[model samples]
Target: MSTPAVRIADLLEDVPTASNPPAPLPAPDPGEAPRTGGSTLNITVVWGDLTEVAADLHVTGHYQSVVPAAAELALDQAISGGSRLIIKEHTKLGWIDAQLGEVTYFPCKAGPVRSAAVVGMGPMGTLTERRALQMYASLLGEAVALGHVESMATVLIGSGTGNLAVSQAARALVRGFAGVLALLSPPTPPPRLTEVLIVEVDRLRAEQLHLALITAAESLPQLRIAPRLREESGGRLSAPSAAVYALAALARLAGPQSTPTRDGPAGTATRDGMPEGPDRPGREEALRTVLAGFDPDIQGKVREQLAHLATVDRTDLSLAVGGSVGEYDDSAQVRMSVLSGVGGLRWAALTGRATVPERLVPVDMDLLRELVNRLTEPSVEDARELPDLLSRVVVPPDFQRLLTDDARVLLELDRDTASVPWEFLAEIQHADGGRHDPLAIRTQLSRQLRTPYARVMTDALGDAPLRALVIGDPGDPEKGFQLEEARSEALAVAARLKNLGVEVSLFVGAANSREPGVDPARRLDVLRALLSGRHHIVHYCGHSDFDFSGTGRRSGWVFADGLLTAQELALLERPPLIVVANACYSALLGSATGLGRQAQPSGAADRSPWGNPQAALVPSLADEFLRLGVGHYIGAAWRIPDKQAISFAEQFYTYVFEGGPGEPAPTVGGGVRRARKGLYEQYAAGRVPPDIAPNPKRWSSWAAYQHYGDASDVLVRHDSSGTTGGS
Candidate 1:
């Protein structure tokens, strides 16, 4: 009986490489000049050979020697051996003169990880590195989904330059972890510039997660950002820098009307039917677009590259050395990876190999350089600072494992779980539990905060005497005061809070300053009242962006003139559900701007982040609410269809209050979620609904389906009354 690892290794050993050579020539070519003329002597020289011997045969173009890849030959031997594990002991060239010392014969059924193949930096190195990269990428999706593990790992897959690069290997590490964990988690990382993703790749930041990247690359970067960034998309990046650039490109393409494929590989050539961007500008049909501009020979889906790496054939090469053991001279070799070309035809190439006599070699130096540059192109990206928005990420079980292990602090609460941490945050302990009736007045703070309840409460509410708080657009008449109409909206919201058991008054047109930190003051006032045991709720609507430039005519809510970064928002204590009527157009438009910031993102070619609104409070509003303590926020990244917006809000409150007893609390965006179901119907009725059906014009965002606070924070469910639902 064999272990899963042995079984896996056996499967790995089955891979094939370059073609094998036919049996050694029975005799030399007649065209070959005899060595010392020592022939069989029985040779009745052919008419041409004897007649034209030396005159033409020796100097004649009668025969040509084809370059054979040594890497391919050794690879063939390993394949023939049929071992469970394959190891290639490559030099700086990733191979010996004969298959360049490539050895793939790991036959262990299962054992502690012990084998490795360190490829030097050269053509052979590059070949191995590319094979490894494609292999790692293909298995990544599955590895994450299923918490599988790989006992052995290999390394030095050409990050040292030459043909292979240390950075390129770094850029392709999906499966390397489980199948090759620790084995390749370089005890050290390469130069920061090696980060192919961002042009100005930050080495300082990525190095921190280099080791833990197997589990934390994408998640941790966003978490550690001290200042809130506008674009927080650190999606499933192979590396932090590449992820940054990939994100930048994704953002640029994520126009309000652009719908790029978020699920594809890093070098996913196209989106939907469109090319990655203007790089391959003419490709209009997304799916039909060719997969290579980076490397013409590169083909196959991400999945194929992965499988090919483990077991490829290489038998065409032949090596010959003529130098002394220690002080010898120049030698040459050839290598190739056999692959099927178009139309079920055969295709292969001399990846690299060293041979003696040098005559066996095939590729000219110039050709090898050309192939190397081409293969390395696509992975190289234009990166910059990644924003703090919630971008797409594939959080596999491995990612989960890393988080769980590193969090160091475990705290969970359920409808029935006991010992909630309500005592940590003060207001909850002393105040009359208002709208937040479901779980009792408890604060949800980071488990690490060491402050006593008294201190935290005093800090949050301040010494203000009284007055329930109300948050909403001031609706300044001078600024086109739609106060009367806006007042109606707030009043409606106030009514909803009351129905949720909030005992508070509604300041229909509350006047609070646009002063910086003013929110804390107003919120503190309400907190004081609640601590003294008053009940209250909150509601608001206006424009907002993650950054705050303070100059745009259509500026969203601004804390200060040019402040209000996302960090400030996320730091809010005990923030409540928030709703914004005039959210950014992208918020309403799902397909418009994939690039997060106001700046529109181009495709993969010239991915850039030239933020929009001419710096109008640059902070992306979506980022703010997301990071903020707001349990659930309702605001558009772009724009929402009017009817969709209205109905989204309407049914949201309806579900919360009227659903049923024991139902979950409703969230801010509950309405939108529900309304989306009827979107197509609404849109077909004259104007297409925003979120319902496909509307390439509108862009969906991380803000669209993302959630905060708790996973149990049900977006829509019946209320205790069993009729109205909750947000």
Candidate 2:
């Protein structure tokens, strides 16, 4: 009679077993076909506990007794009285002196397998791909020598405590198995060991390994490996769905006043066909329950985005500080996470708390206030002192170390810390021992409002033509509030966007009445345009105000007719995907002039119409827009000079709409970083016009802008012809 052919297969899911202390494998069928020669060996990868797999022999790795906990320890614990039995067996057989790659076998009476083999790996944290491959090859060779071994089970050798990447470990393991198979060619009858099973407890790691094995198989066709993955129950929620759910919950928790009250059944539509607000009583709790139904780790939703950014050699460092807005407490707990990946197969995560020093405490609120005041006024002397003040106040040594050159940082802060211009935080030192550059100039850095809810949303203009609405110098020049440079900026940006195949809608104030599609910038017209949802980008170059004493109702941009408050913008049915408010104090989260006080710019009373005792600290225009589901919000943290503002807009638009060949696609964060870098370079070269940067020492307008969104967000997906250009 001929031996049965052995077949090699990789199973991506765990084998089904009946309860713990699993029953032994059923006896081989008597009516089955007799064994045949030229059979292939079967290899399976599964998501399961190693102790539960039913096999003739089990394999595990140990660190030569250097580590107390590892795969071997787990296996020992799973077997009844396994620790004492294994120790006694080893002592009796003198297997205690096993060296690296040496496997010791012992009889098993209480475990799922009839026998177990322990291989000695090197000391803890010393395992590498090469070592793992060699060890696994030796193990398989020894297992084949055991005449009665029909099946064996093992864990992913170096992926756990050994710290090897899932892909690396999987690749090494497959190659090692192949090495043993090569020794016994087709003519030689397959050994008694016809099956090997790799079990992993983590579903994600198992999935990764499944892919890696398939990838390895693609290169090794002779292996004839058939990879199979069984669908697991309870998958994760999509990023857009999770973001929408979280935002809805937040809106519900904001109280009935924030959302329109409902009179009919839940989810009923209003007169305009829009669903009633998310303000139903107990609705927030219901939403929270639904959100919890999925995996609670929200960060998993953005893994794809992080992975995409990582392809360009960028890492994401998100730091979220806990506290309410407008509360300037001495200290707050900060949660920081660093995410980076390589070759699209490996990802590294580092999570920890920000360690603040005692010497930097007692934060000088006054100094922060002065810093904002000087930056708004473009004061060179005061601006030059910012690096020292911010370093001492917020950026501690530990935090500074996290800001690596390739890091794309996002700072989520409450109102207290929000007022500080984090972009202006200087680096500790430059490689050439030159002057340190600000954080924004050195890397792609942005900020977010640290609320209990996450600010995630889907891109409204997915794969659509880029349509922009540019509103410049909305205030009439005769009224003394018009910005001449802003008028020029809007015209130039509109022309540039049009050249890049963007649908442009230009609206200039009376200052540039003849230079646009619209005669004059009107509030009603602008609102109508926004409500039409025809535009994906809104560029407002004008004056804006924030009411410190009142709610966000009074915070908005000044128009030719009146001030368009944030409350009105928030009520829009369809907000633009991106909003660029190149106006002073457009992004400020808190007031530097104290509650119930307004910081009147020198001669502001003459040029501005929106004047008053600004009320209590309220959300800025940027915050309101972001809450309204705008994908990206770019606004000024303070007053930016008109010339610098135009220059920034030009550079920013160019980076976003135009890209050179062979360069990574432009991202919102990348564009902002490039713009800032351009400005810094110009300053360094003394090329910044004197009129724009009157105080050479304070030529830091490049740091005045702030972004609030995912830095990897792509604004223009493609050009007009549907090519792969503007992604």
Candidate 3:
């Protein structure tokens, strides 16, 4: 199994036994996990660095320490828009303990394997910007495994580690995130290099990349983009191609702009070679010093990241951007990196005689092991395990929330652990949230969440108007509840955010009764951006609900065969502050099991969101949302009046943003708990019952359908002095 300097056995191994003598990377202080300063983001600069970052808004994760600041910049790339902290239980050997029972486990079935997506490369590392080019090889390799992607995008994870200059990081990312690598200038010259390296790197990188990619495209049966580039040069970086892994790395290292765009990013040097230096004068030098002279370990790290890319299964149809935040620019880099890196060698489709690697590689066995271990843990209430000590441990709700959500998990585990947003969790409510542009607030919040999740989610969004996605059609204004009401609300909200001077854009899903073509997984990219703290609220009124029957009776439930469950969602790896699903019967469901069998809610029994009081509704949408670990969601009990639904949403949103500029709602579940309390009370009193029918369990003790988590916690309840319920 030993192949080369990097052993094949070692290269393909998973993390469980793929242990390294990691120097103790202490967790940031509990309170400091959310703070920008006095936290532990400084060390990652060496482990892996984010190249194109908004310093004012982002806390560059360092492996060691974090600097403290009162009004910290929000995370740029997070799910649902901006960043929020995901607090997972990180128990080291002598350090923290994983509350097994606290986490949800999915069913272990040797199910039909689906093609993996090839997110070309966003391989985060200490490597130089050049790594982006290398990352393509790995990304392309994955494309071969994945077959294809429904759609893809990228984010930017700038390089701080490695030999990468910000300029080089930019080039690598363009090919990496957008498939559109353009020239960029450093904030300032490297302390030594007077020229902006991005200038030299961008064009050469793109041209050389185009050559390599064109050649690869020729080898491929299909492409992720227009045929123009692929049709020419017939695909070749050089007589020999740029390594797919390198191209993948370029994708990983590039800083992708996160805004949703119809046209891809293209660049030409301005009259001046390139724009360098930050708007601010003196600090540019300091930032450049850090960017250029980062620890050398980072370079090796990029190599590792690139090498890792080679092992992933790639798909032709699907294009992905791989890299940390601040490196990938957006979807373009992800798409482009695939074309440049592995499109040529990749199989045309998943159907033909796909070439398997010479080795017999199993799927991520360790992750599977972790999954099994957590799933089989003795349910807190039911203890039938051999040992009492290893019984599921109790964890706080916050940690539980992080375990369920993808954005939350990334925030909690990535190097930027210290800069994780605590305030976002505390202020997860919109007081009078109505049909206004909830996207603004959501983006704002997500900006904080994106800082660490696979690189900043919003890093690629750049300075564009916000893009929004609504369920109704834009042309047929009438017969839709989202015309003037929602649009006006959107404009007004956008204006307020304008006062704060943030960029935003909006896109809405079509109002189809079915979740048919919509891939909730695709929401990952969008959600990652929201988690970045760029988007504050994600408001949607759609017709959907969880199919609790596990039979999946509901029609048009679109999900990958292998999907995350509500239980897993409960463990928000990186929690998002505000998530609003305003529609009929729309509840989160476990993609893995179709029902939220193993997941739990963020609160107490009455407050628990797993199963309802009635076992019959075990797979109810509410339960699914709870399991999926959504932070704050507002859904209709059943079908509700559309106009009324819109009204309720608008009113609710207004309440949340009542705070002044840059002042978000408190994350301690204050706004959410408070508003929901009123809703529950009104429903209970039968005073404000809507057209929707109420389930009997709604009247029972919030704890009536409750289950206990480990004694410690498994919820996202922050330091709120609110009413507590359930067991």
lDDT of each: 0.26, 0.56, 0.26
Over all chains combined, what TM-score does candidate 1 have?
0.27
Tell me the tens digit of each residue's lDDT in model 1 across 396-447.
1221221211111112221111111111111121235332111101111111
After best superposition, candidate 1 residue 128: deviation in angstroms?
22
Quote each prediction's TM-score: 0.27, 0.49, 0.24
Candidate order by TM-score, decreasing, is 2, 1, 3
Indicate whether candidate 1 or candidate 3 has the larger TM-score: 1
User: All candidates: CA RMSD in angstroms?
Assistant: 29.1, 27.4, 25.3
Cα lDDT tens digits for candidate 2, 616-720: 112256666766667678886555566677777777888776644556556677778777877777776778777765555347767777787556455654566
| Model 1 lDDT on a 0 to 1 scale | 0.26
Better of 1 and 2 by lDDT: 2
Q: Candidates sorted by lDDT, descending order?
A: 2, 1, 3
User: How high is the lDDT of residue 437 in model 2?
Assistant: 60
Across 259-333, the per-residue lDDT of candidate 3 in tens digits comes to: 111123223222213322223334334334434755778855654664454334211112322222211111011
